[model samples]
Target: MFAIAAPSASAATACAKTTDPATPAAPSPGKPCWVDITPYPFGTDGLPVDTSSLGCPAVNAEKDRGYQSQCYLRVTSMAFRAWNRGLAATTRFQINPSPPPTPFGVWLFNGTRWYPDPTFPGASTCYGDTVVWAGKLDYWLIGGSLTGSGVPTVCRYDGSSFAWQPLEIPAETRVKVLSPEIASVRAGACYAWDDCWFFGPEGVRLHWDGTKLNDDTPDISSPSLRGRFGSAAARVDADGHRIGVAVRWTSHSSQDGVKPEDQVRPDPGESAPAQLLRSDGGAFAPFPFTPPTVPGPDDPWRTNLVAVDLDPSGRGWVAGNTVGAGNLQITGRILPGRQAAPVVPFALSGRAACTPSATAFTYAPTSSGLPDGQSSYIWNSLSVFPDSGDALAGGTERPAVGGTSRNDNGYAEPVLTRVGCAGAVTETRFREPDPTTNDAAVAPANYRGSLDAVAANAANDAWAATSSGSAIGGGIPTGVDQRFYQRPHLYRLTDTAKPAATAGDDVEDRPFEVVADPPIFVEDAPPPEPPPAPDEPPVITTVPTKPKRVKQKPSIYSPKVSKPRRIKGNRYVMVVTFRVRRPVTVGVQALRKNKVVSRSGLKRFKGKRGTLKLEITRKHWPTRVRFYTRSGSTR
Candidate 1:
């Protein structure tokens, strides 16, 4: 219920430590020794800079990167850091998805810095472009996107800088590609095989072996049913060998061919697929699954399996959201194997009972019951701790209060869910410092944000990157006009630390130790000078010239009237934010009190997207102005 205030000096305000009780300070409660790398500095929140992916790959033995732990973060620009160094280096180029068909760029960290792999085209074009180190010292980049010809293309790259090649699969006329995943079969060994799976665009599946990419669409036995559709995959491997994968699928047609309106409506038969399969290099072995029913006509009925991994027992544990209408419910499943039955309530305790709409559901703990009326709980990233076998999930919590669901209010808060190896689910929340107290700023006050990527290190420490809103409009209004005021923040969750406990049956209320990186800095241009007082309208004096009568009735001649010359100040700041292909030169002219004060030299703005403030000032307040880029007039 607390609010944040705008900066007194300028409309541009960033989330930082505040002295106000309403907005607290950060850093003190944050995890100790967590790295705080700066975000991409060239652009505003959205365009050129985007921290799209984060990974804490095991330090390769080949590269003695003196650090004990290393992290790679990719935005449209790429950056990486070795924990021991405590500093990050970034690429000069603002990576953007090249036009359709062209591969996006990919960067690699050799040891201390990051370098773009020339073998790969533009910056990573899609989220699926993931780097995997399997058998030998080599690595692979699996990526997917629609080609210019509209053909869905999925390709891979070798770590030794080999050219990217499309996975060889049976060519179908048209297929939409889902995100791709690569499961490492061996830790340090090279010859062991890794599995790459791609699903979607009508239940089509691409299974890539170490040697070739195969169209494994036939793995679905029920061809008559509507094809499976979903974008998450989890494969469990044992001793450098493949075990199986837990995939979520929705059947187009069940035994009962219900009407389009009737399908997905609150019904017992609405249950969908959450199957486990073991493809032994030939065909897929199937296991039975019962999707939970929906809660209401507008609630979730069908299940979606997105995150999956194996428990110590080698049984399949999967996590996903059940969504429909406007509501969403998190769901998890335990696959006992081909012949054994699936367990309904394997993780998280609440919402165990069945509903007409959603037969199964997982409970998410929140302080305020059910969140804002319009809020939805999203659980996107999940990983298993190698040391304790516990599962960690991260996502965004968008409360319904403050601003409407359609508005920027209800800023998102990052949430981490810990599913103990024994299935005890607990939720922890993190936010930027409020300047008042670090612990007081547990949730963001403005704009929308979410956790996009998450990974767990060998020490059971979890790292996540979240795109959250700037503290622009918690309760305070900066009166600045802009489409978005959001930025990204990185977080580290330490398992060994315990948070000050709170009282509640809801597991989410429990405290947990977490450290947040400094918020990405976004400069706001001061408000534009109030439009120069509009020039006064000319006044017409109707002198006693009523005598001006011409032939017919009277030929009325119009008299030329001139408005007083308007004089205005010269100093003004022209703020502009835009994305570009390459840097362009900009010129500005300032007039003070009806006279030219200064003309700035041509300044170049680097592309893809950047925020620029061209300030022209003299003794008087700036009034009129002219601006130009090489392309021409910058209106």
Candidate 2:
């Protein structure tokens, strides 16, 4: 007998390439994600860069109904050093350098191709952290100017060309806005800009009415307002309209010389660092309460709000991290609409814990599970697709498994997480070839890049940008200008062919294929041979019991044998019988010798019966016969 062992498909790696069940699957209802075709450098402009902003079809575009008509467009920011001449090839589009010798440019994608927009006034000086938002009829671009004029610039696209405009603001407000965010609103659009600081009145909000811009700067003089707001999301609510902002307080008021254990407890009456803001008709106010203490034994590590987005239910989601010794520990929560918001932290794995309570954060499981890498991972932006209602979180992560540390001259992976409307979460890490191994066309054990911005269309198509390329082997060889290799990259996550998503531990047996115990074949053990017939004493007729038969002729009539039955290996048993007209002798024997192997006692003419049982070890036949005298002759 032979046996075959068939296990579950998910438990085995059927192909050379398989999803690491250890990592989170890419957003749900889709296959795992792979690195996009675009290439970007690891670091540029002597600072960290990311694809900070994305513009797709606006969520409220359909609300405008008949007045809305637009194509899918995605814009991302990226910067390169002035000395990098091979930068043009780093992006999907051509990087047309400006007269001021601008090294950076904004890349545009129209479904199939990438187009570089280099005429945006200070394109060279702009950091790849460009803020892009799509309106009903135009697309807006806002960022700092390269001229170092301490002024932020805005460029509007009129379908055909871009018109640049410098904002009119007091120099005291700090002409440059480094971390800027834009949200589409009904009146026009609302934006949050800052002077690269958290304290004081360093943050400002700009409300545009399509024709003019108004300033709505909040008060920062109060210690209560000593935080910075970098993330903003606008949604129409019952209270007219609501714009939700993520506030990350930059300072801890007291407990200077406190011990580690004592540091976990906040000073009495101390305000929470993570707060929510509600803005109605340009009047902004706090949400009336603070978040429950996040999981931590140490004071929240260099924690800052980096990403914010509203789910289909209008609940706000925030993602940030507390900086640790060499890495950043990430945590997030969902902000409900009510004033008394309940603390619902994201379920994290390992030593991580939320503050005030040891209750584990609840998180939806992924195919491979959530990323528990050893190093740091930070989210840069988040947005919800209007049509699919899927929430996307974008950021960069240093893979816990491969390569050296960023400080040790290594790489990071760009990560995109998709959360379904039904609360299913899928995480995907982008994989790319190592630019450093171009000569041999090799991939780094851990490829690194930053996705600063992400935008998705109604079709569920998405796009992201890498602000710069790797410091090592990242750019294509350009003999004319070596600096061209340090260019940034833009990529699209369109609906393309991909592998099926693995179900992991969630896999279940189908109804028609339920599991069952294996069958057993008892070949070695055989049925026991029928017990040998008990030995019988010879039969003798008694004179008184049996009347004397006188001159009775003996005649044999019929004979028969039972079919053989196997009781053991190559062993069988059979029975035979014969009839006699008078007291006749009968015998059963193998035909080979014609000798009785077994015999029956005498029988009377009334008929007598006997039994023949034997084991057939080899091929043989048994014949039964009887001899008797009929009349005076024997036949």
List model 1 lDDT by residue over 21-106, tens digit each. 44322223333222322432212211122234333233332322111121222332111121111111122211223322223234
lDDT of 2 by residue, 539-574 (tens): 998777766878744445566766655545555555
Model 2 TM-score (2 dp)? 0.45
| Position 70, candidate 1: lDDT | 19
TM-score of each: 0.48, 0.45
Per-model clash counts, in order, read: 42, 36
How well does model 2 score by local distance difference test? 0.38
lDDT of 2 at 330: 23
Candidate 1: C-alpha RMSD after superposition: 25.2
Candidate 1 global TM-score: 0.48
Count of clashing pairs, candidate 2? 36
